[model samples]
Target: MSKYRVLVVDDEEDLCEIIRFALEVEGYSVDVVYSAEEALKMNITDYNLLLLDVMMGEISGFRMAHMIRNDPKTAHTPIVFISAKDTENDRLTAFSLGADDYITKPFSIREMLARVKAIIGRFDSKMKIGLQILSYDKLTINLEKKQVLLEEKEIRFTKKEFEILKLFLENRNRLFTREELLKRIWSDEAFVLSRTIDVNITRIRRKIGRYERNIVTKLGLGYCFEG
Candidate 1:
C-alpha cells in the first residue's frame, strides 16, 4: 500500500519537527511548514491530511482553513487543528471551518498518532466505497473530481454548493428539510445556520441554469430536486 502523506503547519519549529518525526515513524510521508502562508503556497491538495496550528504568523490557521474550504480543489481534504488555544469557542471555530478533528497543545504524541490513523482510515474506507459520478439529464456530478458539469460544460461551485447539489441529485425526488440538510451535509462538526442551506440551494439552482426550476421549494416543507 502507498504511504499516506501528511502536512504539518505550525509556527514553532520544534513542534513541526516533533510532529514530522512522530508521523514519519508511523510510516507516513510528512512535510512541515512553519507558517500558513508557506502552506498555502504549496499544492495543499496533495496531502491526505493537514495538521494545522491555530495561532500562526500573519495568516492564522483559522483563516487558512477558511481559504481551503472555499477552494473546490482542496475543500474536501481532512484537516486537524493542533493548537494551544483550548477554549470551547476555539474548538467550535475549528470545526466550523470543516476540520476533521482538533487537538489542544500539550497532547500526547501517541494520542495524536491514533487520531491521525483513525481519521485517515475512515477517509480511505469512504473512498473505497466509491463516490462515482452521478448524472441527471444535462447535469453531471463527478464526486471524485469534485466537479459539476451542466450540459457537458463545467460549472464552478463552492464547496458547500457542490455538496448540496450532490446530495439533491443523489437522492432525487427526496424532500430534505433545511435541518436535515444541515445535519447531513455539514455533519455536527460545523455550526451552520439554516439560512446557509437556503443560500447554497439558491446558488446551486442558479448554476444549473434552466434546470433551476427542477429544484422545487415546498411550502412549509423544504427543497427537493424533482429531476
Candidate 2:
C-alpha cells in the first residue's frame, strides 16, 4: 500500500513534532515546516494533504491557502486549517478559501487522526465535485465547461465517454463491474448492450494514449482508474 504524504505547517516546533509523530504512527509520510513562508518556498504538488495553522508570523495560513488555491498545480489540493481561533467567522473564511476542514487547537489526537483519514480517503472525490475540475497529472477536466485536456491539449470525448471518465476519476482505485457501469452510465436507455461499454472503454483508452494504462482492467472483477 502507498502511504499518503502530508505537509504540516505550524509555528510551534513542539506542536509540529507532536502532529508529525502521531501521523507517522498512522503510517502516513509526514513533513513539517515551522512557517507558512517556508512551506510556500517548496514544491508542494506531491503532497496528498496539507494541515496548516491559521496563524503564524508575517505569512498566515489563510494567506498561504489563498496562494495555493490560485496556483493551478495545487489549486485542488485538500487543505485543513488548525488554529486556536475557533470563531464562526474564522471557519467561514477558511471554507471560503477552499479549506477542507478546520481543526481547533487543543483537539483530541484520536479525533484528529480520524478526520485526517476520512479526508484523505475522499478528498479527491469531494474536492473535484465542488471545484468542477478533475485532474491527474497532465490530464484535466473542466466539469462546468465540459472540457477535457490531455498533455495541455484539448481532447474531444463523446457525452457518454465524458461521463464515464468523470465517474472513474471521481472514484479512482475502486473497481466497477460491467453491469455496474451499464447501470450507472447507460441507465434505462434501451438496447444498450454490455459490449457497447467495452467499445467505449477501448476508445477512451486509445484517446488517452500514455495514460491508457491508468484505466486498469481487473480480469473478471471489472475496470478501474488506478491513478
Candidate 3:
C-alpha cells in the first residue's frame, strides 16, 4: 500500500524523529523539518498534511500557516497545529487560522495517530466527493447525500445553502449570474433581493471555510463554485 505523505515541522529534533517513526509505522511517508525557516524553504504542496509547531525559532507555526493560506497554491492544505501550550484560547486561535486539528505537547503516540488518522480521513472523504462531490478540501458537499462535511464533522446547512451548492456543482466551470442564483434559490419575487443572494453566499462561504475560494466572484458576472 502506498503511504500518505506528511510533513513534520518542529524545532525539536528528537520529537520530530519520534513522531516521524510513529507515523511511518502507521503506513505514512514522513519528512522532518527542525525549524519554520526550513519548513518554508521546502516544497510542501505534495504532502497529504502538515504537522506544524506553534512555537519555533524566527518564524512561528501560526505565521507559517498564514503564509501558506496567503498563497493560493497551498491555501487548502490541511494543517494540524502542535504546541506546548494547551489553552482553549490557543486552540481557538489555531482553528481561527484554519487549522484542521491541534495536538498539545506531552501527547501520546496513540492519540497523535488517532488525530492524524481523523484529519486524513476528513480529506479523503472530501477528495472522494470532488465536483461529483463538490469538494475543495475543507468543505465536502456530497451531491448524492446532499450532505456537507466540514473537518470530518457534519454540518446541517439550511435549505438555501444546499440549493446554492447544488447549482454550483451541477454546472462546473460555468459562471453564475446573481440573477440566476437569486431566481433559482428563491421562487418568491418579493423575497428575491440581490442582498439575499449575497447574504446566503457569504453564509455558505463562512460555513464552507478554506474552500471559500472555490466559489469564485466575478465583479460583473456573479460567482462560479467549480474552480
Candidate 4:
C-alpha cells in the first residue's frame, strides 16, 4: 500500500521533529515546516492531510487554512489543527476555519498517532467509492474518486462536472433535453433551472479535451454524449 503524505507545520522545531520521527516510524511520509508561510509556499494538495499549528509567525494556521480552502487547487484537502490552546472556544474556532480535527499540545504520541490514522483513513475510504469512474473512448471518469483521466493525466473535475459526466456515461449516445438532465442529475431537488445544466455541461465538455467535439449539442433539443 502507498504511504499517506502528511504536512506538519509548527513553529516549535523540537515538537515538529518529535511528531515527524514518530509518524515516520508508523510508515507515513512526513513533511515538516516551521511556519505557515513556508507551508503555503509548498503544494498543499499534494499531501493527504495537514497537521497545522494554530500559532506561527507571519500567518496563523487558521488564516492559512482559509487561503487554502479558497483556492480551487487545495480546497478539498483535509486539515487538522495542533495547538497548545486547549480551550473550547479555540477548538471551535479551528473547526470553523475548516479544520478536520483538533489536537492539543501535551497529547500522547500514541493517541496522536491514532487520531492521525483515523482521519486519513476516513478520507482514503471516501475517495475509494465516492465517485463513479466511467470509461468511454480515451476518457476515464473516476466518479467515486472524484477524478477524471485523459491521456493518462489526472483531470480535476468540480462536483457538478463529475455528476454530469456520470449521468451521460450511464446512458451514452442518448439525447438529453435540458429538463431531462436537470431531473436526472438533481432528482430530488425541485425546480433546477435549465441554465444550471448548461453551465455544468459546458464545464464537462471542456474537461473532455479532444473528445469535446464528441459531445454534440442538438440545437434546441438538448445535449448528447457521443464517443
By lDDT, who's the top model here? 2
lDDT of 1 at 112: 99
Tens digits of per-residue lDDT for model 2 on 1-227?
24589999999899899999999988999989999999998889989999999999999999999999999999978899999999999999999999999999999989999999999989766766768988898988889989889988989999999999999999999999999999999996976988898899999999887999999999887899998
Off by over 4 Å in 1: 131-227
Candidate lDDT values, in order: 0.91, 0.92, 0.86, 0.86
Candidates in order, TM-scores: namely 0.60, 0.58, 0.60, 0.62
Candidate 3 lDDT, 1-227, residue by residue in tens: 34589999998899999999999888999999888899888887888899999999889999999999889989988999889979999999899889999899989989999998999999988776664566555666777777889887888888898998778867877998998887778866666668888888899889877778788889988999766
Give Cα distance to truth, residue 103, candidate 4, Å: 0.6
Q: Assess candidate 1 and give its lDDT.
A: 0.91
Return the clash pairs for model 1, or none: none
Best by TM-score: 4
Better of 2 and 3 by TM-score: 3
Q: Provide backbone clash counts, one per model.
A: 0, 0, 2, 8
Stretches > 4 Å off in candidate 3:
133-227
Candidate 1 per-residue C-alpha lDDT over 33-94 given as tens digits, one digit per residue, 9 for 90 to 100? 99999999999989999999999899999999999999999998999999999999999999
- Report the lDDT of model 4 for residue 103: 92
Reference-based lDDT, residue 181, model 4: 76
- Please give the RMSD to the true structure for each candidate, in Å: 16.2, 12.1, 11.1, 13.2
